[model samples]
Target: MEKKLKKLKTDNARKQIKKNQNIFNIWTKLLRISAIWIRFFQWRKWHKDHTYPKPQVGPLMVAEIQQAKERWITITQRQAFPEEINSLRNNQQVVRGPLRTLSPYLDNDLLRVGGRLENSNISANRKHPVILPRQHVVTEMIYREYHQRYMHVGPQGLLAAIREEFWVLRGRDVARATVHNCLKCFRARPSSLQPAMGQLPSARVTPSRAFAQTGVDFAGPLVVKLGLRKSTTTKAYVAVFVCLATKAIHLEAVSALSTAAFMAALKRFMSRRGKPSHIWSDNGTNFVGARKELECCFKKQLTGRTVPEELVEEGVQWVFTPPSAPHFGGIWEAAVKSFKHHFVRVAGAAILNFEELSTLLAQIEACLNSRPMTALSSDPADLQALTPGHFLIGTPVLMPPEADYSEMPDNRLKRWELVQKITQMFWKRWRLEYLSSLQSKAKWLNPTANVKIGTLAVLKEDNVPPLQWKMVRIIEIHPGKDGIVRVVTVRTASGQQLKRPTVKICPLPMGKEE
Candidate 1:
């Protein structure tokens, strides 16, 4: 009985295996048939839609073109010129529509202009072009097609080309808009936004201690001899510090462009001109690194209670302008220019030693500080005009000593009181003269619309062609105290974010949906 059972089990297992194999074969065959059908259908679709090498214009093709144009014109006219169409159908004049001046009439169910040029010896299409409403999609399509056919010509040329076939309403305005919206034209002639000049910062307009609020910048890699030998030479740089309130400048010579060198220069400046409450500079790598180091030092001193009370009270506050924006630090930039002007004229290709360079810079600083800040008076008896030197010392750095007033009995003659009175007088003149002069904007006199987030723009790069400039999308804006946006943060196509002034961003024309 056991042997008979074993034989039956083996037969049943073999039958089950055979049944599973048959099911697998059936599925594989079905998959192959489906794939073959898919390829066959794709080929059929390609064959049906493919264009012939030399396609003949048959009656069917002509009929299809006529039908499409009629459909498009019917939809467009009904949406835009329904009243005019009704007036024309009733044999009345179009008195109130935009087409009233054009004297439009229907011919073969299509609108055409009834202009005085009807008798001109030209083609029918040119003599009385088909009238199109400007706001409709059909009009846009026709304008775009003609604009492209003319190889992206100017507005006047584009308008003339379109008038050869269609007389679009407000054709000039439409043509201008179409040209403005072209990506290629915009990329070739990208114009940056010109927001109105911003209000002067408090540091610039208000009177303060000389060098209290400072703007710092680096000048150059001036060639300098290492020693008396002319062959042994090394590169050096000038650190220019300008007082925002007084326009006084301090120059320091540094050996290299590094954070350590900058720190040393800063120490020298503070030791001589006093520690500044705020320091403004461009986004140079050395400046950024020094700021970080200073922050770390300040934190440690505060935590350990090692900093003196006076030092803590006079803490340094560093502010950085947006990257690649030199205009933001115009004060120091101007000073650097003045310094170079003097240095170039005086030094004149002469490679001096480091000490000689330092001395020359000091003399130039004195000359700059002694310059008249306000216009000179015509009256010869009037006291010398206020200068940056007045805020630094008691008088101009280059002026001769005045007659001693120690013997005078006036209360202002007292040493401390006289000094205070002199300082007050200087500030009064600054407020009335220098500050007022800054009220008038040098350029960018008109206000424009602010750029919005998600708008596409091109970044203006120095020494780069407009076509090669990177494309960016505005993501954020930085408005001033008066609520004018001058700075914005943008993201590039490579996912890099940059903070740039609006003057460096050229926004592109937006579509209706955008």
Candidate 2:
């Protein structure tokens, strides 16, 4: 009987491994396809612009003529784009970068648009059709995602690199901005730009690397009174560092809310977990603006853009998001939410002190990390039951659950050296294989166009049936170069389509009044 049970368990384990491998295969294929498209887009940036090179300057001022015969520039080649780019071509800005990633729908469309080196990630995302904003993330995160996708340039250089890459893919006029904004280009100043160096991170680099990309944040100044004396009160702070890939966390409670206190907590983590690559947080005055502005009239004139900073030099990079926006740092936000539940409800409505709370945090983290997660939905037994630690670090640690940790590769390398090497190596290999898979899956080329200008389109959805309406004017059309659109709609009354990036257009309605 015992042998039978053991055999069943072994069989289940083997089955689980196979299931994980299948998911990995599909995900990697997506990455490979995306990578090739990016490589092609990088090639054609140097091609020249069509139509009399420079804009024709005369009394005629015929925009229609310019729009009709204009040519599209290869974003990578730094050439010219087609004039039919958009109706607002005259006012459009021609910031250049490579177009990376092709649309899945169209066989030949580039997914990302590009601009000049001077343009920031925010600028490029706004200009291109492919790099749209995600639902839960802030705009900065959107930029971060774009840089990760291309792996060609940093946030600042995305605009330029995108254009260069794009030209290689199609060598066509991208959107309307280049032609409209060319005249305005003279106002721009010149400066040297740094290109992106490291390979992109592999589909999240899960594994012990889970604890590598951590986000640390302080949850509160919990005013809890404890100890034998009734007057004795404790001021405490929760310092949490969560692995990005694994979602496993190392949490603690400290006595005070000072920079000094935070440093002590960090040191504790390093002693055990080792140094992390990135530490995300909210720009608290303690962790951020320690230095006062140097009030020198002469020195102040030297540079206008400066933010106050109080850096922690523990051989780790500290990334801070905007104040009051906790969601910007994903791990920390989740940690706090989980901690609050325990602190307020589970651990008794009673308040906790620095020491007691810290003890509680350790317990909570263990439970959260050990439990398998449902997200790795690919596994049948625990595919859904995989734990957060498994998610971040990757399954089947060097030392499985039964054994202690046998090796620590990070310890041999200096913190920063480890960071750079790991980021470069993992990102390089992952980008190649995984990106190809992304390309195969995200079919953007033959997008289904829903509505057109002058056509009366109906609002369609399941729950909001009555919310639907009749004919309305089609004011605008959001069309990618491939012709298919993401959304189509009318103005007023029973209308649908909440804030999506691309939309179709149709003809205006004839009557409005009853």
Candidate 3:
């Protein structure tokens, strides 16, 4: 009985949802039809009441075309449409009679072609088209008003919308030109070009031990059940440590984003991989605090006081890139991206407990470390491409082989010498294959002329109107070591200063006098 009741409830819920969707579809269709009808009526009223001048087609013809349209309308109304309208609409009405040429398209009180009424002689797609006068500011005003009505849709959309009720000469050309000069459209579009690529840093090219020069970053605020009870929960953050030279990764799960949490994560990393010489990361408050703590510890030890052995011996240096600069830490940022990619799939919709989440992160770290650094060899006879594990463990982590080393007569020689030789060989291959591969710049192509100070620009925002764009002037330019300008500081008319990337700004094309 209970099972039947539950099934009935589910069925009723689905039926209700379907009924609501059908109603919504019907209402939407009615609204669209009504809007189109209202737009047609407005166009008809506008055409009947407004008088416009002739458009300039060049010299040889110098009279108003609006007067010609008026004359043609009067002739058609009085049942006097000439057999040839070339002299009535296309030509100035210098002559009028039954002998005048009538327009080819004429039907009972309406001009009809292709079963459609010809309200005006201007044809964007018709021959013997009634030419709209250039002085017809009302026609252009109608076009502009319609363009704004559609939220600045492009020329093609505007042409389609305007063609439904009335016709105008060179309508497509006018729409195209109007859309081209639209300030709103220009502010919303993405930048067409970018500055040149910056040079690679020395750490990227230099050979070093795995994790000796590391980049650290945080990835998440994932919620995990804390205690045995499902109701108890806490937030967890993942700290990612990526080796700059080899691209190997280490992940630590911390309880919070704080100085204590980061310090603990750093200690865990150091414990397994050994202390890094230099750590590169963004200027997060926790990271800054950790650096201060490390300095204090070093000072205490220098004063002859006992400190943690790792703190005294490590002598780690924390290097912070500028604030809001994620690209500067792209190495570790990419590593974080990789971790999240695998994590989402593996933990899909599961509210894991803390221990479970931690274990999964460790497994993800192992999988990333084992991935091939380059494409796999197609030939069965050739060895596979080298990975970060090859530098760290002298073998792939995916299928770690059993220990096999030659026994030496002396205890110190065999184990130590073989490990050193294997690491040296890996570094040699890394320099030849991996380091050389980083030479090309995949993005930020050839540089253009630098943006000069005092230049006017609009700060781009998501889903904002063009008129609402903040007017700003470039006050400072920040060029990377490669001498390519990617970021700049701008001051608004309100005296507010903001630092924005070049991608987020659209500089106005200025005239020499302006």
Candidate 4:
């Protein structure tokens, strides 16, 4: 029985390998065809706009054209393209000009259009009709002949190169179609512009206290000396908390990424910045593990851990963005980048102890958080850049202070009302200056149609040939709230499914639906 099972497994493995080989062969064939088309297009383009050495049409080329014309005429008499011939005849009658006259001509018992024959009177002139067959084979042959001479120009240029000696009926359209389907051309094409920006989340649009709705992310594995020894090296991580509403940032230094270290960092953040109503973080293992432990504490699973009970009851929610989707947490991610940029320069070539590193991190955090929230005014009289500090402390960090209201009479307003007035003023400026800045899109200007389910696509791989490109069919579309498909689920020939962003997928050209 065991022997039979082993034989069955071997058979399945062989079948799988054969299937993969077959798929590879199909892709190879497609790419080969695409290469031919690309070369033809390249030759055509250069021959049109650029000037090059005129190619001499030998007797062999002339004889080949003559043979192709004869073949086409034979086919035409046999009624292979009776409709096309009849249409041409009708067109010749309706037109009255040199072009109309040129549409009908006889050469060596075969009907030809365009190009005058060379004679002794015009020995310098090389213009002549090089008749071509109706089949794709003859057209490609003509393209290759001129392509080698013109050094692979595109469609328009190639047509110009051939026009000096030959004219094929509807050659322009045929050349264009071939160029459009070229794999080489497609690979070299620029990336398509992205769709319009999606709407801002409520956290960004709403006005709230600093750190009320926050995004948390970690940065760094900076080297810090342990104890007093210069050789004892330890890694330290920084937990960065960014306020979604006010863009205020808070930094915490942790020794490790364990649950205990994160919890300690979170406690310090809550103590100084106040408890966050909602915490948004990426799907990191540490973050996820922390959430699970917090849940256990919230559910009273651990004995004597009752301090977080009230905080849980009051709705301290932790939300995680999708796995592998870092763009979802771009706000905090940007903060992390700014932090790393400055920290790297400040701590250059020095390995500081934990206490020293902690102080430097705090200083860097303050510098980043004080950066302008909106564009600076150019006028000298209008001082003070609008920054996150304005929302947190009611003024810019380095700018001169305004008139103090702290010493005002007690009868003027209650303590809560005074705070409310200041907050309201900050919000008013935030709406006027910050909100307006969000209107312009910095990238991805053009909108494209959404990729539909069941559409065939090729996965683009860098430094890899098109024949090796993984082929798949769209199984599902994951559209954003803006009704644009950004991500999709695809199924391969091996029956495996994968989730990929639209940028990585290259849809195959197909006919329009009827």
Candidate 5:
């Protein structure tokens, strides 16, 4: 009997909830049904709201959709749209047309209007005001205003323009393009040219002789390790070397990159694989800052080209890449990639400081030299992997280098025709074949072509026609549509008003950029 009474109370509570739901509002009308009935009868309410009076269904349909468009600051679109709406109504224009939705206020109005019309059973997708998207019109308006006011753009100029002038902020080129296309700028964009077939990049420099030349690249200033026993933050760096002919690599890690570590790396390089004839490193602090600064005294000047002097003493020629041309330092850069891929997989993070770091370099170098590589040798058809040591094994020490303090003996060099002997000794055999077949036809070492106004260009200061050069300032900046740029002096000390001369820029036509 008690269980029956408790069940009765629970049923009463459920019935109370059902009765309360009848008062809930749905759409324009109040619902008056039990919760269970509401669920069961929802389809009837929807049909009553959505379906037109049965007789009205046979008439041809007429409806409008509204979308938002940008408006001028001077006009309130609320006024403009209503006036347009009244005109449409009075004219009895049967054609459904787009409504211009402007501003968020306008767009919100249009959205609400669309929602209302949708609620009233009209199609929301067709013939709406404000067809131009908020993002699109704003972007167009801002850019159009800017291009009219400021004709040219710089890196800083562009940044400032985007912030204050262009409507879309920061690196939003896609929106800019959209706006650009919709506005006056649509007529200004140049036609794109047909893409030419890409030529194969030349194989990395193949020196005339083996072990005669080597290239260098920096790999890391890896995250400092505190200690194997106690972690403390201290730094270390890695340097890499690659042979020109065989493509084998050498890697070394140094503690603090002082003159001391630099020298130690050189010594280790020489100890393992004999000395190279030529060395190529970028203008890095480690390679350039090894010497003390020169102080002018009474009569004479101190001369120390630090790393270059060291290379000269070691009988190794030194060549540096033209500034801004990392492509020329291809070998070591490739080796650097391999090092990163290998180091991450193998290096232990617990080790820190120079001592431990330098100790690990040998193991890293071994891994780099041992990896199988598929880059074609001088011969396009041949492929091989000769690890650093493998290339040296059983090779005749033809001259049995004396490792003397002074230069080679005159007789031995004379007998061997040193230059020819070195060339034949080290060049990949396939290269000799290629050279034998190569033409001596004329070509420019630094190719260039005819210059035009607004032709994108990079200036060359030190890279003139001579064998060696320097680049200090941008000698030419292409000015679009503003034809000839004539210049007399780059140094403002000389004068600023002088005409600027323009030079042909990069991606020079095959034979032209020389």
Candidate 6:
């Protein structure tokens, strides 16, 4: 009996070995037909004289196992709908589940939708797409793959494309999350942060002497004739000085944009209107140079044993807004706009000599200063609406004479008392009319989340598309007094550093936390 059992086991082992050898031969032949090469010696070792070695695992078996491992959708479906699959196979009706209403059924061991469109002539995949769980990893991969395949479309479009072959549970929510997480989609249509509007600077709201706190800006490269007889022309720019307190403007024409030219214009401005205590301007090249020169002058005077009193008295503090931020110097920018509006109409296409241009600028300045600072009153008894010129010279620069208060009784008012009273009245009106108007924000009413250090962002550029905007990494943030981040310092991909306002920086969806 023992001898018979041993013989039977040997026969079974031989039969198993022969089956594996035949499968290996078929795989080798297929590889050869597909132009894949195997060493002749290796082939000979295995198949010499039509005799095979002991059977081992083959490439076909390994490949089949790998393919089965990759079918994550099947594994998930089996885990989620084992009862539904079993019931369908046994021809039993599905009782209660998310898929009960869909009338799901098994096709090739995979669950699919069995909706009313079974009789439609459309493709099988479209009529009954594979149902997937919304929160599963496989479903996310499929959503992302189809999203990119269709050119990173919006949530609805991505869902529509996915439903042609897949019916993801809560597909709209999944599609939205996928698109929101896509780096390319976020960068293509990025959103910039808009913090709440900041408080007005003290220089702008406080009452002071005209031109005491001033902002300066350049207006144009206006064409002016160099000589009347020769018709030779050159470019001339207007230097606009605006009072931060009163909004009165003074215009000076410069032959060129240079340190010396700007200094000369500054001297002219001070000669007409007294030297300002503080001057604010954008960081133009000329302004930067002027600031450096002033610093050097101060250093030299301090080093000397006997400093000149005139130099010390003439010292002016210059303030510059961040580079490339024109909005920071909006007071002077608005003044430049007012200058252009009048200059364009007065000068037109006619090119005038330097003297004529200067005269025209002076006339425009007078007109701008005379504009009403407050709304005009319909009642005739009310005093004329206050103007910037009123703060400067106690009346409109272009207005006609009014009834004389000089002849009033001594008890009513003296000359000095009348002057003081009129000055106080002007300031009181300015506080009630001009300063109160700034309380309401015109835009950016709501604050957004502040960008932190190490966040990725896109630097906005004029005349450039959003896709072409440079990627940047935030290295620093400059928050306002209200603790809202309005500006940030960033390093670009090329390693260049730039300071930009939050309005010009489009932050990516994912930050350092991700």
The lDDT of each candidate is 0.84, 0.45, 0.70, 0.69, 0.44, 0.81
Residues 1-514, candidate 6: write the lDDT tens digits: 9789867854564344333332432322323322211223235547754575433334434443333322435666876778888999998878788888898988777889999997899999899988888776556667777787789999999999989988888899999988987879877888777888888999999999999999999988988899877688999999999999899999999999899899999989999899899999998999999899877878778777367877676789998888767988888999999999988888899998999998998999999999987678899998788889998888888887878866766764566797899999999989998888778888888778899999888888888888899999999999989999988999999899998898888887762225
Give per-model TM-scores.
Answer: 0.80, 0.34, 0.64, 0.67, 0.40, 0.78
Per lDDT, the best of the predicted structures is 1
lDDT of 3 by residue, 1-514 (tens): 9799867864564344334332422322323433343344445646766553322333212233333333333333333334334443554442444222322343332332232334556553342333232223334544566788889988999987766644555688878755755556666653422667777778888988899999999988998897767687778899999999899999999889999999999999999998999999998999999999989879889787587666677699889876556877899999999999999999987878888988998899888988887667689997667898897777767765677544636667766897788788888888877887898889877678888888888877657776677878999998887677778898999899888777666787442223
Query: Any idea how many clashes model 5 has?
Result: 36
- Ranked candidates, highest TM-score first: 1, 6, 4, 3, 5, 2
Q: Mark the 10 consecutive residues where model 1 has the least summed lDDT.
A: 21-30
Count: clashes, candidate 6: 0
lDDT score at residue 158, model 3, on the 0-100 scale:
94
TM-score of 2: 0.34
**Which of candidates 2 and 6 is the stronger one according to lDDT?**
6
Give the alpha carbon lDDT tens digit for every residue of 1-514 in model 1.
9799867864564344334332422322323333343344445646766752333232334444454455446545766888888889999988996888888899876888998897799999998888888875557657667777789899999999989988988999999988998778889998899898988889999889999999999999999999876679999999999999999999999999999999999999999999999999999999999999998888888788897866865689999998999998999999999999999999998999999999999999999999988778899998778889989886889888888856867654576786788789889989988898888888989889888999889999999999999999999999988888999999999999999999999998874524
What is the per-residue lDDT of model 2 for residues 154-265, given as tens digits with 9 covering 90 to 100? 3235544444323223312222222222211211211111111222233234444556777777787777667635668867788877766555778877778876777778
Candidate 3 has an lDDT of 0.70
Q: State each model's C-alpha RMSD to the native.
A: 15.4, 30.6, 19.0, 14.7, 22.8, 8.9
Ranking by lDDT: 1, 6, 3, 4, 2, 5
How far does residue 88 in candidate 4 sit from its true spot (Å)? 8.5
The residue-by-residue lDDT of candidate 4 on 1-514, one tens digit each, is 9799867864564344334332422322323443343344445645864664333232324434444344433333333334434555565331543335455444443445543544435422233353443343335545555654565567898777766655556678656654544444444552332455567789988988889999999998888899666689989999999999888888899999888999999989999999889999998898998889877777773356656656657656899875555776889999999898998898997998988988998888778778988888889997466788887777755556678876866854587797788778778888988988887877767788888899877765568776677778999988988898877888998998877767768876542110
Q: Of the pair 4 and 5, which is ahead by TM-score?
A: 4
After superposition, the stretches of candidate 2 with alpha carbons farther than 4 Å from their true spots are: 1-208, 226-231, 289-314, 376-384, 391-514
Pick out the ten consecutive residues of candidate 3 with the lowest summed lDDT. 54-63
